[model samples]
Target: MGADHAERVAHRVSGARLVAVSDADAARAGDLAARFPGVRAVTDPLALVADDDVDAVVVASPGAAHEEQVLACLEAGKHVLCEKPLTMDGESSLRVVRAERAAGRPLVQLGFMRRFDPEYARLKAVLDSGRLGRMLLLHNTHRNKSVPDTFRSEMIVRDSLVHEVDVARFLFGEEITEVTVYSPAPTSAAAEGVVDPQVSVFRMQGGAVVTNEVFVTNQVGYEVRCEAVCERGSAMAGRPWADLYTTVAADDGEGLWGGGVPADFLGRFARAYDLELQAWADASRRGEVVGPTTWDGYAATVVCEAGMRSLTTGEPASVTLVDPGPAS
Candidate 1:
């Protein structure tokens, strides 16, 4: 993801430069350094954070490593942009939030890039305009072709579906009060010993209800979509492209075909990535928090952990949140 972000930053912002990159895999780090001229490759991430030439750090490492890396950057007095699902669990997220508070400044920005998407922004605008009236319920679907074999079973909820969890919270503009996880019928595409699909039901603070379906069996393509039903109207957003059909001459007959997934996840979120980076960069320069803050990341992690507990126990789990004062 760090490599992808670097590419996007280079593409969108001509003035941006890749200074240094670090990863556990030495060869991979070397390749990235070679791809971006003048960028140094290192195995220790702390080195990148401590570099005198480095202005800021982008923490795109694994979910488990984010909290430490983010706090380290903050301790080093450098701004940080960390990727989503902020940490493996809420405890670590809280620690990072506290670290930011101790620093007396907003040094950490959570990467909830979907909030910057034009469609989502438009939806928010409509909601704020009172056109949707009182939002009553929300339905979100996040389907993918398959999950990597290396992915742990717990990650299905924490890392994979957490995207919808965060987005749902953002859209409702309220915290989730309670959550219940349901185990539906199994899917053939799902790996053994793994629940290929799951549904999470959330009760928001303002009496709004939300259901998120995270499925790993949409073999044809990858899809991320949402629908909001309010008192006055409804709104939906998803892939905007239409199927392109072409006539083919075959021995049997002429056939038409149309379907393809987004080339890559980064490609699908290209605009959001650029907007999120620019927002964080501009805010950092002005010494303010313009994007998602450490509190947002902590809240999302808390909700995700609750959802996981709900799934494991087959019982409704209530989320406990710490009021982190005003938004950073």
Candidate 2:
């Protein structure tokens, strides 16, 4: 994902060069660097930060490693763009927020690419225009073909549907106060002893109800859809990759048609990825916080954690927000 971001940023912004690339796998880093000529490959991220030549950093490592990498970059006095689920939990997210505040600048941007997507932006504009007449309900669906065996248990909430959590917060323009988790039946595709599909219901502070269903056995394709039903009207968005084709038989039949689903998430979100990186690069260069802020990331983490707890205890979990660090 970091490599993809770099390529998109390079394409969108002129005079922007990738100076260094790093990965735990030295061979992968070297290969990425080779793809972008004149870029240096390094095994250590610290080396990239220590170098005086590099201007900023993009943290696309796994979720568990994000807090440390983001804080490290901030301490090194470099701007950073870290991928979603900024940290494993709210506590670590707060630490990153504090580190940014202590740095005396907005150094970290969370990679919530939906904020930059055209459809989502359009939805936000419509909602902000007051045409929605007080958003009453929000429904989001995030389904995937399958997750790795190790990721079966909690990844649905943390990694997959977390995007919906963030988007729900953004769309409603309010915080979630409580969440309830419902586990349907386990599917054959899910690993043994894991919940394959889960539904999360949230009550927003402003009396809006939100529900998200994360299903893991969509062998057909990857799907993402959202609908905001308001008193005035309804706005809906989704990704439907149905292809139509027509073929006539030997002067005997009218026509034959077919369609297929998009293979995976990367294909569906390719444009969003490009837009996300371009906005981040532009914002970083202009010294502005353009994409999702660390605070937003922290808030999403809080909601996800609450949902997870609700799943475990078979109860509705509540979310509490502490004071954001001193004004930046």
Candidate 3:
């Protein structure tokens, strides 16, 4: 994601310039820098964050590293766009939230790219227009090509389903109040002990119930879909992208329905990424932070932890939150 964002800012996004990049591997950073003349390559992001030349920071580092990095950037007063799961848990994310509040203005924009996706934006507009009447239920389906060897059972919610977590918030304009996970038997396509297909129920503050069904090793394609059921009618999104793509279909039941899905997420949400970065860049240039905030990141972590606990406890869990107040 770090590399992806750097490319977008360098070439695609307007008003954004890629000045420097850092990676754990200095060579990798240098290689990325080689693509753009005058872009500095660094071995440490902390140095980049503190550089006076760097007016803003993009935290595409792994979730564990996010807490300190995001805090450092904010303390240095650099505008930031941090990728989701926001600090791996609620407490760390909350600290960032408080820090942003202490700064007296929003400074961070979370990377919940679905908010910028054309299909999702249209769906949200319909819901907001009351054309869908009152949104009653939202059904979310996330089917991935496969999971990596390092992927674990918990990632089903922490990583994949996390998108839907943020999406539900974006569409309904409300926070999730409760979440429950139902993990069935692991699929053969999944990592040995990992749970492949899981279902989660998320209850929002506005009486909307969302059922998110995630399949990481669907062996089909990369597909994400959502349907909003309302008083007047129901609407859906997530048609396969027009770009070149494929999926897996073995001699089995689930695989039997497999066909063309996006080859990867980038091709699927390319425009969304561009729009999100463009918005962030435009806002940062204006001395403001907009789009998803630190509070939204904090909320996502809270819901994920609750769902993980539910997976073990076999019971519904309530989502808890710190009052975001004005910073949100």
RMSD of each: 2.6, 2.8, 3.7
lDDT: which is higher, 1 or 2? 2
Pairs that clash in candidate 3: none
- What is the lDDT, from 0 to 100, of the residue 275 in candidate 2? 75
Candidate lDDT values, in order: 0.80, 0.81, 0.87
Overall local distance difference test of candidate 3? 0.87
Q: Candidate 1 or 3, higher TM-score?
A: 3
Cα error, candidate 3, residue 286 (Å): 0.8
lDDT digits (tens) for residues 1-328 of candidate 1: 8888877665665445678889989899999888876889978999889899888888999887887788789889998889986788788888888878888888888898888887777787788789879889899988777666665546777876777877777888888889888888768776676676788899999988999888776575577778889999998867334343344566778664544566445656688888888887777777677778888888988988898888889899999998655434
> Clash number for model 2?
0
Off by over 4 Å in 3: 240-259, 324-328
Worst 10 residues of 3 by lDDT: 239-248
Deviation in Å, model 3, residue 1 alpha carbon: 1.1
User: Candidate 2: which stretches are off by over 4 Å?
Assistant: 10-15, 239-258
Task: Please provide the root mean square deviation of candidate 2 (C-alpha atoms, Å).
Answer: 2.8
lDDT of 2 by residue, 1-328 (tens): 8778666655555545688889888998898888876888988888787789988888888888888788888888877889988999999998888778878989788888877777788888898899778889998988887777887657778887789888888888788899888888888788898887888899999989998988877576777878899999988766342232334354566554444445676776777777777777777788877768889899889888888898898899999977765956
Tell me each candidate's TM-score: 0.92, 0.92, 0.92
**What TM-score does prediction 2 earn?**
0.92
Instruction: For candidate 3, write residues 1-328 as lDDT tens digits.
Output: 8889998989998877789999888999999999987899988889999998899988988899999999888889889999987898898888889888988777899999999988898888889999769999999998888778798878888888889999999888899999989988888888887777899999999878999989888886778889999999998878543333345577663554335567568877899999999999999999998788888889999999999999888799999897856643
* lDDT comparing candidate 2 with the true structure: 0.81
Model 2: residue 29 alpha-carbon error in angstroms = 1.2
